[model samples]
Target: MQLKQALASAVERLDAADVGSPRMNAEVLLLFVIGADRAYLYAHPERELTSEEAARYEEVLAQRATGMPSQYITGHQEFWGLDFVVSPAVLIPRPETEHLVEAVLELARGVQRPKLVDVGTGSGCIALALAHELPDAEVYAVDLSAEALEIARANAARLQLDKRVRFLQCNVLDPVWEKTPDVIPSEDFSPSRGTCCSEFRDFDFVVSNPPYVAFSEADKVQKSVREFEPTMAVFAGLHGIDVIVPLVEQAHLALKPGGWLALEMGYSMREEVVNLLSPTMWEDIRVVPDLQGIPRVVAARKQ
Candidate 1:
């Protein structure tokens, strides 16, 4: 079969399955199988596919038909114009998260070598991106899952950002208070080890796209997300503030006076997130909309 014919068939199948952006998905899959760019595929529409190549194309087609995300099948995702390796271990970086980065950069302006922490740093997307843009900044990322952290570490190495970004395995839900002088402990403690009391110090900035999907809204999510993506990165709680509530409080405690806190939240979560911030802790609280004009990012400053 010719490459063009195989691509057409794959796209048709995806369309039949009601998959959005079928043509784009088909083209990406074809490029993956043929190891060629879009130009090559267009210039050689009549090129014949070997039996092995045809079989591989069919396999990818089947996966896509089942509603698996294209990025997961391709093992890579683009965020902030840079490609990062992705897998089932980590949530695929979404375009909406770019706004969070932009908001952070806007706040980072004029700040010298700012210290930033990305809580629940899945795939290290936010932390690594910030480190790349702000080479002098001290960036630290933490996640509860070791498997997710492994992928994050690998991506940092791939982007040659291993030296700038640090990864730690941490469960943000657990009480972080260690028996020490500081408010937030500077030293890392193993979860297996007994908890200690340490003062948690303030950070220059704190940013996150923590899990905010409500349990009741699960049916509204797409199959690719609900099934393939990790639940730890998705569903929050009955009110979807399981992570957001604590994260906001933590950011408030972790940020130095006047430090900024920016977060990406669900479309229907703007008001709820705003309410999450107390007047005494956060000032200038506002929700920013994304390209789709949905209120997605909430930004504020510590008082």
Candidate 2:
């Protein structure tokens, strides 16, 4: 079968299965199966696929039809103009999260050798991007799930940023947690063992794209996300503040005076998330909306 015919068939199947962006999904999966770019696909539409290639295309199309995210099938996603490795173990990095990164960069402006931490760094997109942009900064990424950390570490190595960031397995900023040993530690990295919030403090910025979806709102989430993505990386709790509450508390404790905390939240979470940042402890609180005008990032400066 020709590339065009296979793509048409895949698109029809995906559309029938009620997948969003069926054509785009079909094209991505086809490109993955054939190991070709969109340019090649267009330039060689009439080219015939071998039996193995056709079978592989059918396999991936079936996966997409079942609502498995294309990023998982491709094992890659682009964030902040950088390619990242992703999997079912981690939440797929979204474009909206880039706003969170931008908000942190704005907060870090003019701060020399700023120390930063990324909570719930599923794919390490935020931490690595910050490291890439701020070559002199100290960056750390922490996640509750060891499986997710594996993928994040892999992405760091893939981006040739293995030495630029530290990965730790911890929930929020738990007082006692050990750093993942695979990642090379910086010369100034202290403790080299389990540590407390005392050692985690004095950051110039604490940023995250944490799980903000509440369990009650599970029905509102897309089927693919609810079904295929890691549950810990999706739902926070009954009120969706289970993760955010502690994250806010730890960020407040971990940040130096005047340090900033930036977070990416759900469309409905601006008010609730903002409320978590107390007026007595946090100031200059602001909500940053995405291109669609949804409140995507909430940032606050420590008082």
Candidate 3:
């Protein structure tokens, strides 16, 4: 079938399923199936798709119709203007999280070879972005799920960033509670490997887009997100501060004096994040708003 006809059929199915942005979703799935870009699709609307291509397109459309995220279907997402591999094992990188990256860059402004840690580094988005921008900086990415860490490590390899950002499996950058992985004992990264101490110490920055969506607010989340995305990457206890609070404290221990912590929080989390950093131990705290003018990132420095 022609690309246009297949796309139209997919859009109709997705729309009937009550999916938002059906046309774009359909186009993405079709392009993914046919291995073509939007320009190619438009330039060759009458081009025929082979039987296998048509079948693949319809299969992805069916998944989208069932509320599966298009990103998950494509196994890819664009973050920091770079394509990242994604799966149900990790949270899909969102645009707002880029603000977290921006905040870190602004704060890290003139520092050379700064050391940074990304806690809850699902898909290694924040750490990879930072390492790309600051090639000389030491970047460490940690996550609780070993599965998520594997995908993150794979993404780093795909992007030629694996050599810069090291990946670890730990919750919130806490002291390694368990034994070390095979990568331990390397001088440059021994601490992140597993020492069970303040091995993560003295980082110039700590950044994260931690789980900030409250479980009670599940109804506000989109159908695809609730059903298809990983839940641990979304809900953070009742108030959503469950993870952020601990991350803030850990950022304190890991950061050197004058180091900064940059975090992306829920739109409703500005006050709580502010209060959490209100203590004298933290200073230069500031809130950054996204394009929508909602408070999307909060940055604070260790005192």
Candidate 4:
């Protein structure tokens, strides 16, 4: 079949399956199969698809028709202008999360050689992006699931940022508090560093795009997210603050005086998340809105 004919057929198939952005989905999947760019798709309308290419295009279109995200089918996604490898193990990085990165960059500008940790660092998008921007900063990424960590680590290596960030597998900040030999080498520590916990408490920033969707609101999520993405990276609990509550406490314990904590939240979580940061423990609390003017990121400084 010709390129234009296959694309038209795929778009029709996706639209019939009720897929959103059927044309875009068809174009992306087709481009992925042919290993070409959007310009090639339009310029080579008469180009014939090889037998293998046609079959592969059909396979991916079928996946999309079943509510599988195009990113998962292509095994890739772009964030902060950097391409990242994604799988079922990790949540596909969203564009809005870039606001959380911008928040940290703005606050960390004055700090020299800042230390930052990304909590629940799925795909290592925020951590790697920070490392890419703040060349002198020491960045660490932690996640509970080893599978997610594997994908995150691969993205780091692929981006040639493997040496820039440390990938740790543990529950939240637990690995940072423990005196693990593999986590923090002895030579990396300073004599003035206090207790085991204190040794890792001088982070200038803590950033996250954690799971903020409440279990009760699961039905409200997109079919692709609810069905394809990792569950731990989406739903928090009954109230959606289950992860953020401890995350705030951990950020407080992990950050140095005046260090900042930035997190990406749901559209309606501005008030609830702000309430989690106690006045005594937090100050300069600010909520950042996305391009849509919806409350998206909430950042605060440790008191």
Whole-model Cα lDDT of every candidate shown, in order: 0.84, 0.87, 0.85, 0.88
* Model 2: per-residue Cα lDDT over 209-300, one tens digit each: 88888999999988889999999999999878899998998788788999999999898888888888889999999999999999999999
| Candidate 1 lDDT by residue in tens digits, 1-303 | 998898898889999998899999999999998889999999999999999889999899899989999888889999998889999989999989999999999889999989888888898999999999998998878777788888998999999998787666666623344443332322344444334222234678888889889988999988789999999899898878998888887777677899988889999988888988889788988788999899999999999
lDDT of 3 by residue, 1-303 (tens): 888898888888889999899899999999999898999999999998999998888788888888888888899999998889999999999988998998898888899899998988888888998899998998988888888988898889999998898777766766532343432332335645646454678899989889889888999988778887888899899888889988987788888999999989888888888998857799888999999999999988899
Model 2 TM: 0.93
Candidate with the larger lDDT of 2 and 3: 2
Candidate 3: Cα lDDT at 303? 95
- TM-score for every candidate vs. truth? 0.92, 0.93, 0.93, 0.93
RMSD of 3: 2.8
What ranking emerges by lDDT with the best candidate at the front? Answer: 4, 2, 3, 1
**Better lDDT candidate (1, 2):** 2
Off by over 4 Å in 4: 176-199
Clashes of 2: 0
TM-score of 1: 0.92
Please give the distance, in angstroms, between residue 261's alpha carbon in candidate 2 and its true position after superposition.
0.7
Pick the winner on lDDT between candidates 3 and 4: 4
